[model samples]
Target: MHTQRISGQAGQTGRRWGALAAAAALVLGAAACSGGSDGKSAGGKVELTYRIWDSTQQPAMQKIVDAFEATHPSVKVKIQLTANQEYWTKLQADATSGSAPDVFWMNGPNAQLYESNGMLLPLSDKLAANGVNLADYPSSLVSLYQHKGKQYGIPKDFDTVGLWYNKKLFDAAGVKYPDDTWTWQTVQEAARKLTDASKKQYGILAPAFGQENYYNTIFQAGGSVISADGTSSGYDQPAATAGLKFWTDLIKDGSSPSLKSMTDTFPSQFFESGKVAMYYGGSWNSSTFAKNSALKDDVDVAVLPQGTKRAVVIHGLANVAYAKTKHPDEAAALVAFLGSKQAAEIGAKESGVIPAFNNTQQAWVDATPGFHLQAFLDELPYAMPYPTSKNTSVWQTQEPITFAPAWEGKSDVGAVAQKMADLMNTALSKEK
Candidate 1:
């Protein structure tokens, strides 16, 4: 709950309310719960539960909990660590049933639905009461959690995409280091230069179904994913077709790996093995990449090449308290503490993520050497939020199959793309 690279539309009043809401949660908790509930008895302590997907973040969050307890003697915090996909599904079920934890991670894609449905509390007043300023966190991301004009959560950490290359492959090919101004044409040319068909290696990873790695390109092509009004699909443009063509054509041209080969193995396993020249992905892949000692000192980062636009995707995880919590005050307190700069630093240093708080992120960048993390930070201001909406879960779940035909060559690009836009429009319409 601080901010890193944030995604989604920041509202007109989003940042103003964010600063106030985070502080209000803290103030409301300390004032309303102190000596007011059964929390004061020698045998009883206020228990607040937190849930998150990263098991690696547990120790860091524990440090935050320890700090919170040191300040509030009557409160004891419990942490429940859930890993990736399961975390979202389980959290959804619990929240829908009104049995969610005191505080849990919220993602941009689903933030709108949660906030719009009144499942999340507006924290502006509570943050104001605690006397903290939202200006400390990344204001761009704070807007994602606000709906209609109320702040619902605080950013934890955010990420941006970069062109991660296999250093060993580049060296083997005697290619020079990649620079900031590299373009899609340059990347394709380089991939062609570095490719060794005999060794079963290619220039780049094939485009995938997920928006995380591919959406930014779609955007950069001067294409749109959703309508300007945020009410329908915007993928029917020539830019989108060009964006799709950029990758699939690479596969058709034998510049990138075959779709069949990539289908069996994702970039994580393939690219990290030095079997691929470059792949566009998030900064979060560091820890996983660090495990590849074979590629040690051989891998480096660069800004993603621009298309018609210099666009990048910004994403974040946030802390949101269930509106139906029985221990509202205690829950809010937990949320506030999580959103603090202190918690931000703990998470950044211990979990090794790019911190969400503006001040604490540099330490994370410095955690490793030779990675072009600065490029990622520099890309933030021009970054575009992922095209998420009130029913993002639907989009995320449907994308793999929706984009599959083109990937499989079973359907032509224009027809598949047009149908995709229509289907997306239908889904967004269902939300209305």
Candidate 2:
């Protein structure tokens, strides 16, 4: 649920990151103003700035910071909360001006951009020296922040997609609730039955989204977004064509609302307001749904239905330290502590996010009762990591533009997919 774009309340990734320019010059220019180790006060007190974009998660993050401060008596950590829309821009400006935070949140779309430019401090050696074990976190998450075989961020939390349905709608349609046994055919059938054109009620909310929609299906259909070596695009593959068509077919069949309608009003809003019966969203939505008094009681989630196979896209936020931080030791210490089981436990009990630390996910499931939150955790075994490359944002920005015609029912999905493949390949070829 972490990206560099307009991160929603569910912490879902956004798709709008600009390619960084003059990164090396920004790094060197920041060294003198980073305050260096000599800036410590006479009392030897160190102040470290930790920044994050999601205000919903600030309370839990603050608790983690407090715990770290408790153990490291001389360090005072300040939390900087910025809106997602401005987070990356502000970070970029700060980096260029030598005023970036000591540590901050990092996501898949921008990780390589910052890491490859030497903007983020490598955590492998420090984590090992601090007795922190990367094995404690999800492997997919651990690998997400790695650039050129070195880790730059510590895995914080993870989220996977699920199928959320309204019991009231299913009951009205006399359709059985979805479960692990459900397949693509099962969903299509149910969607057709539940949809009522007269009532303006769609069976499902299928937006032209990656992690929440096509990415999972692409993997389930045995296709991938990028090749293993990150040098090619998979959009032209037959499997990818099938995956892309899944949503377009729904639009064409009148089972899902038109892409324009879904775009005008977010799919989540449609589901929350009862305009749609089912929604494919991330695990982060559990807390959001729980808070909405109107839909909380009637909403429940299930594993994503199978295509060729069962799959979901997994993504997470990482706690990354700035390489130019003056208090390098303190910054790394805070990062290490944040990645610990204790911090993950705090986040599980307090925050809505699923902790990346192994065995702590149950606490999150237990935290939210009645809604079968476990569906998100259950898919982890086969969940594919959210696809990324040295500059993932390059092609990510092209997805909706390239697929809009098919989504609007004005073009063939297969044809649009091939066009997308060519565009993605061109973007990949230009990467350093």
State every prediction's TM-score relative to the real structure: 0.86, 0.93
lDDT of 2 by residue, 275-300 (tens): 78889888877877888999999989
Query: Compared with the true structure, what per-residue lDDT tens digits does model 1 show for residues 1-432?
Result: 121112211111111011111222232233222221223335588777777766667788789889988988888877887655356556555654446677788878767766766667678878876545677766667777777777888787777778888777888898876787887788878978987789988888766544435577788888777775678776788888777777777777676776677767655567777788887767776656766677757788888888888888776778888776667777777788788888888887787677778878887888766676777788887777666777765655555567767776777777777887887888788777
lDDT of 2 at 164: 97
Give RMSD to native, each candidate.
Answer: 7.3, 2.6
Off by over 4 Å in 2: 1-38
Clashes in candidate 1: how many?
20
